[model samples]
Target: MVKSVSNITPFTLLDYPDKSACILWYAGCNMRCLYCYNPEIVFGKGKFTFSEMISFLETRRGLLDAVVFSGGECLIHKDIIEQIRLVKAMGFLVKVDTNGSKPDVLQSLIEQKLLDYVALDFKSTRESFLSITQTDLYDQFEQSVQLLFKTNIPFEIRTTYHSELLAKEEVKDMIDYLKFNEYTGTYYIQHFKNNVETIGKLPNSHTRLENHLPVNTAVKIVLR
Candidate 1:
């Protein structure tokens, strides 16, 4: 099957923790978060094929440390599990960036030892989930989060802070959901950068919602 990989960043030191890696940006996503900056990949088709990506990876074997599969929700692609396995076999650590909507794929990767790190987006609380994602994926998203909490795989849970879709109290609710569920991992409060096209109306320029986040406990918070 043809994979929906849209673009690739040959190298970056920031994407994966402490590793020199390349980014595989996939195409299309199941949810349409209003604050998302990657609308092109989320709504458009990919330009490259799975075989092409493999050919590219083949050339980076010794020079790179890891490969990051970010998307348009990388796990939405069915062929990702096999691709991860292939990359792992090629002697490179694999990191996947997902919105935590597919626990089955995430679990499969963990069980098969196909990934080294995971960056799951904790978009919103159940109350504001539908408004943010524009999908009935709240249950599925929660399942992925809980599954990650139980796994040994290293992960970073993040949220896009937008004043238009979420408030200070609601942001705390999202953080609380993680803490209540025994999640003690790092939770990043990502401030929405108005650099690209978003799904819905844009927030006002002064809407710095990240500054309003409530103090959270038990988990490490990295403000960006």
Candidate 2:
């Protein structure tokens, strides 16, 4: 029922906070964001099966503290819950990186106590969701954001920034919405890194320049 794992980073201190962990990159995505960095993962075929992933994890059991299920939309896999359960049984904390499109799946996992941490992507404001993420699932993302707030689950919500894709003013609107909804956590504004593998390119003038965000809101914005 699972798809495939595109790649694996055997160890990383940066991926998981306060814990050493391995990162498993899953193949395919539900959204086609213009500034997506992992286009190959989103568009290409995967190399390893779920069994292979388990075998690798088995080798690293005593060394790493956690396993990060990153994507190309990791939650889209039908067998993710079962996979997470197995990983949790293996004595490793499990973290999932997602676009927040599958809130139902996220809720189910959180309720079952299968996840340790979640990093959800918040693409853009409600009005610009479609144009920014190139998907019709804005409402789902909003619901997922709200759902996480009510849960006892530890999580972080972030948005990748590119001046052309999401303007500072538009991001302010999104922040306002988050404040109105009482989103109590920090909102990350990650600078876009452009390269040949980028799914969609920005205008020539804006390509590698980080969006200089101003301080004007109640919500915390972390730059990455």
In terms of lDDT, the poorest run of 10 residues in model 1 is: 204-213
Off by over 4 Å in 2: 1-3, 204-217
**RMSD to truth, every model:** 1.7, 2.2
**Per-residue lDDT value at 119 in model 1:** 92
**Whole-model lDDT per candidate:** 0.85, 0.84
Give the alpha carbon lDDT tens digit for every residue of 1-224 in model 2. Answer: 34488998999998777999999899999999988888999997778889999999999989999999998998998888998999999999999999999989988998899988888898988777899788899989877887888887778888887777776778777777778877767788777765545777675326432344446767877777
> Candidates' TM-scores?
0.93, 0.91
The numbered model that scores best in lDDT is 1
Positional deviation of residue 80's Cα in model 2 after best superposition, in angstroms: 0.7
Cα lDDT, model 2, residue 155: 83
